[model samples]
Target chain A: MSGIVLPRRQLIARAGGLVAAAGALPLLSGCDAINEAPAVRKILSMGEEMHRASQRALTDRDALAREFTRADLSPVFRPNGTRLPEGEAYAAHAARGFADWRVAVTGLVARPLSLSMADIRAMPQRSQITRHDCVEGWSAIGEWTGVQLSRVLAAAGLKDSARYIVFRCADRIGDADYYESCDLVDALHPQTILAWALNRQLLPIANGAPLRLRIERQLGYKHAKYLSAIEAVASLDGIGAGKGGYWEDRVDYEWYAGI
Target chain B: MTDLPPAMPPVRVYRHRLPTRLWHWLNALTLLVLLMSGLMIFNAHPRLYWGQYGANHDRAWLEIGSTRDAGYLRVGSWKVDTTGVLGRWTDGEGATQRWAFPSWATIPTRYSLADGRRWHLSFAWLLAIALTLYMLWTAFGGHLAKDLHVRRGEWAPRHIWRDIKDHARLRFPAGEAAARYNILQKLSYIGVIFVVLPLMIFTGLAMSPGFNATAPWLIDLFGGRQSARSIHFIAAWALVAFFLVHIAMVLLAGPVNEVRSMITGWFRLPPAKGERA
Candidate 1:
């Protein structure tokens, strides 16, 4: 009992020291030099990895994103990030009703294919009412109709080495075209689609007209609107900023935004 | 002088336990991070709604926004020009920024939804796991039944009313009476631990898309995802209020002794009236 009573003082002191260390981290992180430290970055990355691994452990690999009834659809589905793509190429495609636009699926595939809008629409299509969860703390339910991306990947005969799918979009934010990528696990999800229609109508200009990748399990940013091309790659090393997505590269958004 | 009667000092009692102290401090840090990061995340939308869905065109129950001339905060039918405080304010750099919650109250101190989310989700795991472990430890370790649970005699309305009256007068129990928590303290602890914390954790998980895939019924339980978000915001504010009241009570009771008790698990119990120190 005497030993237990004496140790309390030491316990308090040790706890105080640990708390002080944790408190100092934000102060040090505020400085550019300290924030850029490999150890600090590694710790931050480790937190994200832990979260991703734990969430993955909880759910099945092919678990579906929740589907809702038509009555659950929002009165107006809000468009996030860049509303429209600018440039002559996108304008030319839009002007011709995207008739000339083709989604080029190349790199590490047995048969590289340039699929026209007509060709994509002619494929067996699926329509579902799913909630679009924005990373910015809002959600809206909308109906989407499209061909499963896995079907397209199968049609192109993805090479066994294809580990990730990179989406190169026509939308430009700053100097670079907005781009995003996902692991093959997400790519092959049953509900992941290259949606050409919303609410039984042609996709609106403000809502990724012509085509948008609706990877339902992730946040709105991962959906990658105004899609121009798809590339199958074994690694994300050489992609734009190389963190798997535009926001992930520029703003340190986690690549695996399952939540 | 050596033969004179000796003076008695205040009695020291072991009040809080070590695990409780550890849990309290950890919760303090986690809650602070969660609240600040949550506020920053809220700044992204600046609106709250009821039912299943809401957007720019749809009506919202609450909104914080700014126009060219002034800022406004609206809740239900009531609206206030909260300019220069809530909806719009100047930051450390003297640049005007529009936000629902000011820069001082948010993580990053600047607009970055991505960073805000990263902090919020990371600390959420800490809060959830810690609370779970703490609850389990308190229950199985006999702390709950021994200290937190109100006694049969104390449950009487007269006794409860007396405790309330004493608290209203800032008259905390002393000496032998102070060895255990008062009925009021136990009740508030129960409210925060079992009610508020669980609500916060559940509503938070309800808002996550990935979690929704696993448990869509949670969203339905809260009426909708937006409803869950609204409830989360409200509960966070409730927690903040609870924290403020907790700190105020600590100060009122005698800061040094109260704080030391929480920190070191040893408390100098206040003497009863006409009793020797």
Candidate 2:
């Protein structure tokens, strides 16, 4: 009952510490409006604990959210983000049918690769009828076929030092560029893919065309569109804003935006 | 005046009731939990963009990224590492493992997505019920509208301005309930109780699969499912920020007297002379 410690502070020599005594009395009243109610705080803490527990419980990349059937596709699969890249570089790539397009896989790797659109298409592929969960609150189910990200990682070879995978993009939001990332587990996930086509067609400009990541297990933002390059890194510290992604850097988006 | 017969006080003018006390304090506590847990959840997948409330190429309602689900998939043994650590459950004697992500900032997940779904949904129910009951009782019993309703006096521009000034000073003025609550308190309480919480609850339901069909109006209200998700997260952050600041204020304003009134439903007073209420 007696175990209590309160840090004491001086009101200071700056100005009048005036009426410090009156303030002291309310300090004695527990559950004063100034203080958080214990139960609510407990719930808040509990919520945090639950989240921590969830993190501790789930981590294997192999276990995937069940893939749905083709009938599950939304009547209207609204596209999110830039429908089409605006800049000359993107326009040039778009014009060429992205045939000459190349995706560079560098940064902390054994042997970095610069793969062409054809090269990516040639890799053994898998398709899943899954939902595209956009941050904006709509979901569209589409059958996406592409090379398993794990296979590409195996070929490009990630170094031990690499802890994060960054996707450099060709799209820009406002002034900053579009980039996103994931950790090794997510990076190595079997369902994680870089799809060049959506619903049996080369993805249109509205839906991350030519090449866009369909990180099936995650929300859409992690699926960096307008694919330009990918980098693997040890820590997110040195990257843009040291947080890992483009939106994360400019806006306040969290680094590990796992769904 | 007491010498005559010390007449029994003419029916107690005001007495603190335990139920009211419990409701108030519980409300306070639950809000705190909701905010923190909400923040931890947001931190796990921090990304927001502005646009129309739809499933269009522009705006989004929610963003259920890999982190939200994958972050919670840790199984059996979970560990935290320097870079960051998360989990996964191995089934069939490690022959197979499902669910995995790497992160520390995320609110801790308890199990696979299914488990998370159960826990989160259940807790959401708990909050929904508690708030609902509290609101109903307060409304029917005339407790909330009577005690907390912003009056003409409170709404008066001068008083409101004064409260704003006092708040800017980061100190309540010397008066009844000045230390207790002033105009600003009403604003926040009203914001949360009347506005934010409902938005939170409704948006949550809007994103939920069970409610999508039953409540089509909700879906139309926020544009789409993803938009609801975004609103949910952003609004969550706002509440979390409110809570952190609120807790810091409690520590600053003196937690004892504050806690006591909510706990005991009584305040050893300075009377209206000094008390701001």
Candidate 3:
């Protein structure tokens, strides 16, 4: 096996040829081709997959994101992505202090739920001060208190077919409704929360008030804010543009934004 | 004129080896991608902060921001409006766009943080592997001792001062001495290889949340991700300065000779004056 390894130059040449071939295959795939050269597509997918696999393999699956001291918290945690979700429906919910708000949990679960804000707050609470690293090159620390998503899934009793957890948000950017998803691993992680409080107070509207998904290990975008519903599915094929998230659909943001 | 002897033949000596040449070209490409993509990434949050956390509402040590009609550059309390150049600018077709660095400086030549990251991260992997191998080869092959390492004698004030003075006068050693690196070259190379590159790689890893979980100590060593980011940006600029100075020296010494030596490994050393072949 060692003797069969080609020299670096030969390996590069062979890879380049394969990349060119991959680039040419876009014609057959049409719009599903990710709007990039197949070569780039290959590299991006391979890189993301390798990153995900390596993280899973090399690190403890339950290893938590670094927690910070209260001193480390930003004076005011910045609101990222869509601040206040538009439309009268969300405004009406906000007006009544989310008295009528209900998170409809459906699909591939034995007990589908329509849990309210009061119900979520009533569940076991976990609060931790953690850093939020934005993909856009800034980081801020904030204290978040909410229910663990794993407990919610367990309450609903996940069916064997449920492989992914998708969050549908009320915020709309550019023309589409915002959405994001995660695999079972992150969805069931101990730190993953349905956070409704920040800095010892109710979550401000700008910071995904009422509720937001806090998948601590992922980038800020994956923490989908203004969350309205949770859906369990076996495959992401039918999700928005078949890529999982709003940003992932619109742009080529990786579905598995683990970092 | 008739009494003057024939000019001495310039001796050809091996300067950059194959590994060095390979590393040079690869680094050139990778660093270019890293810098351009890095600039694009920076444009997303054109602000810098100290300590562990910073956001829009928090105090930023530095920022390049734009209003609806104008651009401003801020450092702590100081603010400078730099319209049509930074914060806001016109592209090639005269369309206005907001950017800290111009579009020409970024990858894709347009605004796309996602694409910038793809280019940056992909090349990052390539650079890490290449640099690790190059460092190993340099250390094991005696290249570090033979050419890169500054000798104890060379560190003497007089010797260092002479080298600096010679450099200021655009004077390089000739003949046998020219074949080996000067003290300045040795020190700068050492700084870049040992200090800058490693810092870049470490700070980069510190930014990755995956690495943070696997090696949380790295983030702590750098005083959190935001500090690591600040250091990374500062180091990148330092590297840019090093690159500019390196190119300037190459141009001063003789671009053709210096560039050819890096490419082909056979450097033609200038003959000593008043010496016959």
Summing lDDT over every window of 10 consecutive residues in candidate 1 chain B, give the lowest-scoring window: B107-116
lDDT, each prediction: 0.82, 0.58, 0.82
lDDT of 2 by residue, B1-277 (tens): 5445443322212334566677666766655445534544443333343322233343322332333224232112432321112333322223222223221122222111211222344356566777787677767777566666777888899999887787677764433464344677768867876678788888876754323423456756987555676777767777777777777766666576556656776544333432222
Top candidate by DockQ: 3
Q: Which ten residues in a row have the lowest lDDT in candidate 2 chain A?
A: A1-10
DockQ of each: 0.28, 0.05, 0.30
Q: Write the per-residue lDDT of candidate 1 for residues B1-277, one digit (tens) a residue.
A: 7765476688999888998999999999999989988998888888998876666667889999998867899999999998888888876547788888887787755566766777788788889999999999888988899899889999999999999899889887888998888888898898999999999999988877777777878988999888998999899989999998899889988999999999999999888776752
On the 0 to 100 scale, the lDDT of residue A41 in model 1 is 55
Judge candidate 1 at residue B235 and give its lDDT: 92
Which runs in model 1 stand beyond 4 Å of their true positions? A1-38, B1-6
Q: Given the true complex, what DockQ would model 3 score?
A: 0.30
State the lDDT at A45 in candidate 3. 63
Write model 3 residue lDDT over A25-66, tens digit each, in one string.
Answer: 333223222324567666756656766787788888888888
- Candidate 2 residue spans exceeding 4 A from truth: A1-53, A56-61, B1-6, B9-23, B29-263, B266-277
- Candidate 3 — which residues are off by over 4 angstroms? A1-38, B1-7, B67-70, B78-81
Each candidate: how many clashes?
0, 104, 0
